[model samples]
Target: TAKASAPEGEDRGLSIVEVAKARMRDSVVENRGQPQTTRVTNDEEEDDAEDEDSGQDHGPLNEAELSRMAAMLSASALVVASAGGRRLRKLHVDLNRILDGKGNSGVFLQYVLSRLHGIERKSNTRLNPEADLSVLEPYEEALNLALIVAEWHDIVPQLQEQQDPYVLVSYLFNLAAEIGHANRVLRVKDMVSNVAEARWFLFWAAKRVLEQGLELLGLQSVEHM
Candidate 1:
């Protein structure tokens, strides 16, 4: 039962109840619009928080961890060289050249083999007698070194044209295998049966010899000497 309060001049005045009904209608409209604004604000805050958390989770590795990882990789490479054996042979050839005429070849070769055998025994990873020919192959670095030695000593004539020394070394190993010197030939017919094993032995022996030779020359053996 709301009524107009007064008619002044030609205008009608609204009653208190009508004014209250109009205010209530405006309030409902304002409330419906306000929820969307509040929801949008909440959504934005959630998105920002997720972004911050993602950034925190993806931090870089620390310096100590990186150094330790590098050391472990180097150790693994050394172990792989020991297991494969070709690296040993490459070492042997290099050492023989360095020692050149100072030591008996037969004795040196024997010593190299024994050292390699000892490393294998320590590793507890038995080499398969009937494994694939290409199983646990020689390290590329050692093979390259052996090739370089051959080229430097003029063992092969075609190596003279090698522009990139690294490439030449790789080529020599491949060619040697193709031409049947993959196992080093002691004589025309007496080819070593297990070149990979011999190579590993040679590698360790060569490392020892080089270290000793450096000491003799009054220079410290740095890295692999």
Candidate 2:
């Protein structure tokens, strides 16, 4: 959720994440209050048509929806926790790349959704909560993933104490990337019998970890990009 104070005077004692979220939320609110005309170009028209075909509404977004979008935009833009007063000549905020299912945000959601879809297609049933991951014990990548998650918890406290969002975000990016690589090598979806079930549980565990990380950043994972 993108949290914002009620038009506060000073931003004292606010964490960097809070400040960013508040600014984005305020921007959305100000823009919504303005009187404006919208131009629908050819590409936009096509996009609207596609959305309509998919049973999506073309109506204006509600407050909650707007807040979520603002949150994601803020989270996506905060690449560095602290720059030591450094400045960039040009900073680009690519809304398309951020929202269109690309980059770290997209990769995180994509891995989660893809795993769910793959599991469903293979089993046609829910993942077995008690499925044994023993089949994955011998895999070096699997063990490495377990270690990454364990390490994440250990560093979280120190990272929070330092007020560094960059490290947390980077951790998620690496976690997602490693899972993707492991899936390619393990071919979890192509396994048979207990191996498939076990790997499904492993993937589910990773998905849950990703979801927890996204929640910490106040970003919601999407079912679709």
The best candidate by lDDT is: 2
What local lDDT score does residue 31 receive in model 1, on the 0 to 100 scale?
A: 25
How many angstroms is residue 140 displaced in model 1 relative to the true structure, after the best TM-score fit? 3.2
- After superposition on all C-alphas, the RMSD of every candidate to the true structure, in Å, is 34.4, 10.7
Off by over 4 Å in 1: 1-104, 130-138, 141-225
Q: How does residue 1 of candidate 2 score in lDDT? A: 17
* Cα lDDT tens digits for candidate 2, 8-28: 355567765566666656655
Per-residue lDDT, model 2, residue 73, is: 51
lDDT tens per residue, model 1, 71-100? 332222222222223321433222212122
**Candidate 2: residue 95 Cα off by (Å):** 5.5
Runs in model 2 deviating more than 4 A are 1-122, 188-190
Q: What is the total number of backbone clashes in candidate 2?
A: 0
Candidate with the greatest TM-score versus the true structure: 2
Consecutive 10-residue window with the lowest summed lDDT within model 2: 80-89
